[model samples]
Target chain A: MGEVIVITSGKGGVGKTTSTANIGTGLAMLGKKVALIDTDIGLRNLDVVMGLENRIVYNLVDVVENNCRIKQALIKDKRYPNLYLLPSAQTKDKSAVTPEQMKKLTGELRNEFDYILLDCPAGIEQGFKNAIAGADRALVVTTPEVSAVRDADRIIGLLEANEIRRTHLIVNRLRADMVKEGNMMSSDDVVEILAIDLIGIVPDDEHIVISTNNGEPLTGSDCQAGQAYMNICKRVLGEEVPYLDLEVTKTFFQKFAAIFKR
Target chain B: MGFLSNWFKSSESSSDIAKNRLKVAITSDRAICSPELMEQMKNDIIKVISKYVDIDTDGLDIKVTRTELDDDSGTVNAVLASIPIRATKPLRR
Candidate 1:
C-alpha cells in the first residue's frame, strides 16, 4: 500500500505546483515509485512544470470519463525512470470531476506506487475538495506572508474538520535576509500560527523561476531551493533530516569571527 | 538621538505588526462567535453584577481571546469578561 499525499494551498501562486513537481522528482530520484496527479483540471500546469507537456495524450478527465485507462493517462517522466504524472484536463472545469471519482482514482493508484502526490488547485473550492478526498495525508503549503499564513490557518481548520488528522506544513519561498532584517515572517512564526508539524522550508531562489520556465523542476539542479526540496522528499520518506542553514550568508563581522576561530 | 529613539519606540516593524494582527484575527476567527453575541454576553454580565454592587458599566471589558497552552502544546480560546466595580453598597442592619 502506498501513501496518498495532497499538496494544497488555499491561496494561489504560493508554489504548490512547484513543490509538487520537485518533491515528486526528488522522491523518484530516491528510488521510490511516485505518481504525481494534477487535480487542478482546467488550470493544469503540473505537466508543463514537469516538462511532460509534449507527451500528454490523455488526461485525468479521460481516465475518469472512461475514455482511457488509468495506465494510458499516466505520463512517464523522461527524466526520472520511476516518476509518472497524470495530467489534468485543460478543457474541462472543476465540476467535471467529482470527489467520488477522485477517491476511486487515487485508491487505484495507491496500490501501484510508493507515493501518490495530488497537486491541488488554489482556493477552498470544489477542486480543493476533490484533491483532498482520497488523500491519506495533507501538506499545506504557505509562504511567509500574513495573507498566505492566514489562508493556511483557514485551510488547516477545514482539513481538521474533514478528519484529515495527519496534516503537515511546507513553508515555501522563505527569504532568510528579509527574515533576519525583521521584514518577513520566520519559519517559527508560521509554524506557531498554523500549529502543525513542519515538513520542509524552501528558500527564495531565482533558480526556481529559471527552472520552471525551462520545464525542469529545481530539484534536479544544485540550487539551495532544489536541495531543500530533496530534504523534503527525504522527510516524506520517513527519514530524519535536519533543516539546511538557509541563513548561511553571514555579515562581515560574523565571517571574520569564523575565520579567527578556524 | 532622543527623537529618533522615540520615533522607533512608538512604531513597530511591519512584520511585528503583522504577527500581532494575525494573532488576534486568527484567534477570533477560530472562536467563530459573532460580535453581537459577545456584546450581549457583556451586557448580561454587567446586569447580573450590578444587582449586588455599583459597577462601572462603561469600564467593562469583555472579549473572546485565545490563550496558548503550556509549553507549545496548543491554544484554547474563551470569552474573557472583566467588569470593574466602583464600590459596594453598605448593608443597613
Candidate 2:
C-alpha cells in the first residue's frame, strides 16, 4: 500500500503546485513509482507545470464521474519514467467531485503506486476538504512572509481538526541574503511560529522560474531549489536527510575575525 | 550621536515587526472570538456586577488572551476579567 500525501497552503501563489511537481519528480527519479493528482479543479496548473498539458485526455472529474478509467486519466511524464499526473478538470468547479469520491480515488491509486501526491487548491473551502479527505499525511507549503505564515497556521489548525496527524512544513522561496540582514524571516522563525516539523527549505532561485517556464523541473541538476526538493523527497521516503545550510556564507574578513575571537 | 541613535532606533527591521504582529494575530484567530463579541461580554459582565455593588466600569479590564503550555500540556485559551468594586450594598437596603 502507498502513502497519500496532500500538498496544501491556505493562500494562493505560494508554490504548492511547483512543490508537488518537483517533489513528485524527485521521488520518481529515486526509482519510486509516483502519481500526482491535481485537485485544484477549476484552476488546474499542475499539468502545465509538468509540461504534460498537451496529453491530458481525461482529468480528475472524468475519473470521478466514471466517464473514464483511472488509468485513462493518468498522464505519463516523458522526462521521468515512473512519474504520472492525474490532471484536474478546467471546465468544472470544485463541486464536480465530492470528498467521498476523492477518498475513493486516492484509495484506488494507493494500491498502484508507491506514493500519491495531491496538489490542493488554495483556501479552506470545499476544495481543500476534498483534497485532504484520503491523504495519510500533509505538506503545508508557506513563504517567509507574514500573510503566508498566517494562512499556513490556519491550514495547520484545519488539518489537525481533520485528524491528519503527520503534517510537516516546507518553507519555500527563502532568501538567505535578506534573512542575514534581518529583513526577512528565517526558516527557524517560520518553524517556531507554525510549531511543526520542518521537512524542506527551498531557497529563492531564478532557476525555478526558468524550469517552470520551460515545462521542466530542476530535479537532475545542481540547482539549489531542485536539490531542496530532492532532499524533501528523501525525507518523505523515511530517509534522514539533513536540511541544507541556507545561511549566507561569511566573508573572509568575518571568518578571520571569528578565528581571532575564538 | 543623538541623531544617530534615533536613526538606528527607527531602522529596526520590519521583519521583527511582522513576526510580532503575526504572533498576536494567530493567537487571536485561534481563539475564534470576535472583538465585537468580547466588547459585548465585557459590558454584560459590568452590568451584572454593578447591580449589587458600586463599581468602576471605566477601570474594568476584560480581555481574551492565550496562555502558553508547558512541555506536557497544551496551550489554554482563557478570558481574563478584572472588575473593581468600590463598595457592596446590603440586599435589604
Candidate 3:
C-alpha cells in the first residue's frame, strides 16, 4: 500500500506549494515512484512550481469529470523518471470535486506509486477538507510567525479531532539572521509551542524565489536550505538526520566568538 | 508638574504596549480567558479573597505569568501572568 501524504497548512502564503514541489522532487530523486497531486483546484500552482505547467493537458478535475483517463492527466517530469504530477484544474473550483471523489482518485493511484504527495490548499474550508480525505498521514506546514503558528495550532487541533494521528511539522521561511537578531521566531520556539514532532526546517532563501521563477526547487541547488529540504525528504523515508540550525550562517568571526564564549 | 511627574502620568494606552501580546493570544489559543474576563476574574478574586485577609485591590496582582499549567496527562509550563487588582474604598453608609 502506498503512503498518501497531504502537505497542508492552515494559513495561506506559508509555502505549501513550494514544500510540495521540493519534497516530491526529493522523494522521486531518491528513486521512490512518487505522484504529486495538486488539490488546490481552480487556483492550481503546483504545475507551474514543478515547471511542468506546459505539459499539463489533463488535470484532476478532468480525471474526475471523465474528460480523460488518469494516465493522460499524469505528467512525467524530466528531472526524475519515477516522479509524476497530477495537476489540479485551473478552470474549476474546489467544489468541483467531493472528498469521496478525491479519496477514490488517490485510491486508484496508490498501486502505481510508492508515495502520493498532495499539495493541499490553504485554509480549513471545503478545499482543506477535500485535500485531507484520502490521506494516510499529513504534513502540517507552518512558518515562524505568530499568525501562521496560531493557524497551525488550530489545524493540528482539527487533525486530531478527525483522528489523523501521525501529523508532523515543517517550518518554512525561517530567517536565521532575523532569528539571531530576535526579530523573527526561532525553530525551537515554533516546535515548543506547536508541541509536534519536527520533520524539517526550510530557511528563507533568495534561491527558492529564483528557482520558483524557473519552476525549479532549491533541493537541486547546493544551498544550505536545499540540503535541509533533501534531509527532510530522507527523514520522511525513515532516515535519522540531525536537524539543521539555520542561523545567519555564522561567519568566521561569529564562529570564533561562539568558540570563545565565557 | 515636573518631567518626572508627567512621566508617571502617561495614558494607559502607552503602558498597554509594554505588556506582552502573547498572553492575550495564548488565552484565546487555549480558549479559556480574555482581558475583559480577566478583569472580571480580578474583581471576583478580590471580593472573595478579601473576606478574611486584606488585599491591595489596586496593588493586588493576579498574573498569568509563564509557568507550568497542570493537566491530567503531564505538566507543561504556560503563561504566568500578573494581574494587579487595586482595592476600592468601602461604601459611605
Candidate 4:
C-alpha cells in the first residue's frame, strides 16, 4: 500500500494547501508517482494551485457517491504526468463525506500511487477528522505566532488522543528579522513549546502570494521558501537533509571583518 | 564597571553573602512563614530536644530553602531532606 501523508493545522490561512501543492509537486519532480487529495470540502483550492481545476469534472464527492468512478474523478497534473489530484467538491460541505468513505477512497488510490498526500482543512473539526481518518502519518503546520503554536499544540494533543503517534511540525511564515530583534518567537522557542520534531521552516516570502495568484507552486522557482518546502518533501521521503540555519553568530573576528570591509 | 562587577562577583565570600541575602529575601516571596518563625522553630526544636533525646544544641540549624514548584492543589511544596551538615565548631564565650 502507498503511504498516506496528511498536511494539517488547527488554524486557518497558515498555508496548509500551498505546502501540500508544493510538496506534492516537489515529490513528483523526484519522479515519484504521487496523488494529491484535497480533503478541504467546499473550499477546494488544490486543483487551482496544481493548475488542474479546469479539468475537474468528477470531484471527490462524486466518487464517494458512486456518481463517477475514482479514475474519472482523479485529475492528472498538466506538468507532471505521474502526479494526480483528487479534488474536493465545491458545492458540498465537509458533512457530505464520511471518514470511512475517505478511507475507502484513499485505499483504492494506494494501489496505484506511491504517495497519497491529503491536504487537510483547518480547525480541529469535522473536516480535520475526515482528513486524518485514513492517514498513516501527519505533518502539523503552524506559524510562529503564539496563537498558531497554541492551536498546533491542541491539534497535537488531539492526534495523540486518536492514537496517531508519528507526527512532525512545519513552522511556516517565520520572519528571521523579527526573531533577531526579539519581536518574534525563535525556532528554539517554537520547538520547545510544541515539543515536536521540526521538519521544515518556511520563511514568510511575498513570492508565495505571487505564486498563489498565478496558480503555480514556488517549488519550481529559485525561492528560499521553495527550497524549504522541497527539503520537507525530502524529509518525508526519509532523507536526512539538515535544516537551514537562521541563527546569527556574533564574534570578535566577524566584527573586525565587518569593520574592515565597511 | 562591567569587568569590575564581574571581578567582585567571582570572589568566594560573595557567594556566601549572596546565598545568605537570598535566603532572607526569597523565603518571604515563596511562603507565608516569616524569618522569625524559622528562627523560633530552630530554638524551640533545640530546647524541646534538650528536655528529651540529646541533640547537638549548638549544632542545630534550620533554614528555609526556596523550592522550584508548587503542587497541583496550589500549596507550599518543600521537601525537608536532611542536609549534609558540617559538625558544630567550638563556641567562644
Clashes of each: 0, 0, 21, 0
Write one digit per residue (lDDT tens) for candidate 3, span B3-91. Answer: 46546765432223212354346455554577788778778876776664555555554544223235533233244434343454464
Name the best candidate (by DockQ): 1
Q: lDDT of each model, Cα atoms only? A: 0.88, 0.89, 0.81, 0.79
lDDT of 4 by residue, B1-93 (tens): 445765666453432443344444544433347767766766776665455455655554454432323452211224232223334435446
Model 4 segments beyond 4 Å from truth?
A246-262, B1-93
Return the TM-score for each candidate structure. Answer: 0.83, 0.81, 0.77, 0.70
What is candidate 4's lDDT per residue for A8-54, written digit by digit as tens? 98889898999999999999998899999999999999988877788
Where does candidate 3 stray beyond 4 Å?
A249-262, B1-23, B30-93
Model 1, chain B only, scores a TM-score of: 0.57
TM-score of 2: 0.81
Residue A229 lDDT in model 3? 89
Model 4 residue A239 lDDT score? 98
How big is the positional error of residue B55 in model 4, measured in Å on the Cα after superposition? Answer: 24
Tens digit of per-residue lDDT, candidate 2, span B6-77: 477766676788888887677677666776676677788888988889888878877544444566343445
Error of 3 at B73 (Å): 12
Docking band of candidate 2:
acceptable
Across A1-262, the per-residue lDDT of candidate 3 in tens digits comes to 7899999989999999999999999998888999999999989999999999989789999999899999999999978889999999888898999999989999999999999999999899989888889988889999877788878877877776566767899999888766654456777777767777899988888889989999987785698779888998999999999987665666879879998895
DockQ of each: 0.39, 0.35, 0.08, 0.03
